[model samples]
Target: MAEGQEKPKRLYQVWKGSNRFFCRGRLIFGPDVSSLITTIILIGGPAVSFCIKVNHTINVNKKDGKDSNYWYIVLFVAALLTCLDILFLLMTASRDPGIIPRNTKPPESEEGFDMNTPSMEWINDRTPHLRLPKTKEVIVNGHPVNVKYCDTCMLYRPPRASHCSICNNCVQKFDHHCPWVGQCIGLRNYRFFYMFISTSTILCLYVFGFSWVHIAQNKEGILKAMRKDILSDVLIVYCFITVWFVGGLTIFHFYLICTNQTTYENFRYRYDKKENPYHKGIGRNLVEVFLSKIPPSMNNFRAVVCEDDMVAEAPSADHVRTSKEKIDIEMGDKFSESNGISLPEILQNLHYDDLEGNSKDKERSVDFDIHPSPFVFELGKRDELVIAHETENIHQV
Candidate 1:
């Protein structure tokens, strides 16, 4: 509030999701950032050993008056692959994973709903009050698909979008939350994530193969050759185990890419059982995943947001009440006072069968008060109305 003082806070400082920001908010990471440390150790440790072994092999070849240039090339290729793998890993981890911004409140407008459509009719008419449907039918690629409403995000998830529980945010075109990368794989960074794993597979194989070559060149038994350079044995075992992980991941993701499916969808939806509406041919799927231009991030984490825009002590989506729910609660309180009955007692006594039988009689006995207003209203106007109502009640008291 003072002159010459910073009044606004950067968006990252007040971000509600369990994400970490770095490089002045230019990079975003998930809650398990420490996983990246393990990744680095796994990569860098083996690379150092590989380089040392290759260099030593080259030196022995030179001392024996044999061509060492081949070994030099092998060392160079291994180093290059290691560096490339690390670069891809960083790209996948730091970039935005296509997080969708959270709404300040649940949407009140009937933008996506059709009240007059017979298909929208409730299956259960026994309910006391109307509530939003759990799933809505959407058309994707000329086929009707049902998309579930995410209660935590308070929105219908876009086609292929899902909420990452680890990141605590809804991501567009979500693949999965990858702990190895310490990031969610989604629309923005999934390409890089795939590249990282594939490159890692290549690097592991490269090291594994050359480590064997180093052992074979000794022309001794396997045990004697391994005893001569224990690092080679260590690398062989390490890369062998590592290849199964990263290599298997590479193949699995290749299948996903070719099929135009995400890990989340492949596992949960099981497109094998049903037709995959998103499947273009394999060629087109490859182009869509690898060659398509990525969209820019929805959030500007470094942007300074004013106090009015900042939602201090913001409630989670589950705790935040919708306008309809608030109205129902207030009406319930008023009804309880008038009838000299607690809200819980009234609820316990209310029966669906009785309501169905006495619907016509209750309509005659109960006088209804209703108002017509625009479905959408400005937040400022809503705040003003709330303040005025509170002031009137204070005066009465």
Candidate 2:
């Protein structure tokens, strides 16, 4: 749009990750056999409802063959899922998802130094952006606005803020983008998202567990469910077989979350072709991610790391580090305690990064930089934009 200015290369990501789902990039929480997840949800939602209608309940009076056959179908699906979970675990231990590590180029401490090898720390080890200029705050819509323009998403952002491409807004408490639920988890919808996952896991386990009862109630039906369709009908046999695929994904994700690891970190446990300077970004970054600390960004990437973790075993997952143990964090002088939620004070409670925000932390951090080009959330807008264009077209036509 300007002289001598070339258009930026198109960056595409349908999900939370930076890479396309089908690329050699690894799958973190999805189905073991790849895009099997979409099918599982599609089928599970309907199949479960159908089974409930016919059987009257998940725990039906199954002294009869039909009841038992239904149970076997459940078990058949569950067992298959167990195997997928095993595969997911193995993949986590041996695969690479290509995580973008924190930047060590500026070293937070040294601005002008050019070094070949950046420091080896995790993404959770650095502040996301340079501190805003020390000045009085301006209140916007009754709330104080802290940061200037975000170079990453290319807009002025507020504290406790982030840009969600799926929603195409700077959401507070930015969580991962989810495709199945058709929403980005932000501060407002995060509770529902967590509830959805927690409940969904229970549903999977519930269905999988009942399969055992089905096998016990009717031995013949159980065998039939397990039997590979010798009829050579791929469609019919797959009904039960796909159970293994979906079940595995659900269980695998359960363990990973309980132990406090993202699909990204789980894969990072294996090999990464890119240099992971910020190897321990998880150590305590969840608080920041969940709490939503927006800054004047450069790229869409945020470089900040949290002081401590919220989960019980948070230290192991969020605090996990590869090398370089020493860390100093800085806190800014101005911090808001709206509704008694004080970030600067809370950040002070952590062991990593100094509590003095401003020019202080910028002097010490080694591995982290905010990435530019936040998500291009253009969903739901198509209808609105289309309507406006159509109005103009009608007038012209």
- Per-residue lDDT of 299 in model 1: 80
* lDDT tens per residue, model 2, 1-397: 8999754331222223322233322322322333335534554553444345335434464643334565456545644543453333333222221121111121132111122222212223233332222111322222333333222222223232344443333443243455654344333444334434444454444544444443444446656744632221222344355446555655665554344344433443521332222222543344433444433212222222222211111112454433332211111224333333222221122122222223334333321122112112122222110110100101000
Best by lDDT: 1
Give the per-residue Cα lDDT of candidate 1 at 318: 51
lDDT of 1 by residue, 1-397 (tens): 8989986789888887899999889889999988998998899999988998889888888898999889889989988998999999999999889886654444333222333332222222222132343443434544445444455544445556677879988787788999899999998899999999999999999999989988887777877999988898899999999999999999999998898888987776557567876788899889887887776676889999876666323334455445542221100023223444322221122111112112434232221111001011123432110111100101000
**Alpha carbon lDDT of each predicted model:** 0.66, 0.33
Model 1 weakest 10-residue run by lDDT: 388-397
Model 2 Cα shift for residue 32 (angstroms): 24
Candidate 1, overall lDDT? 0.66
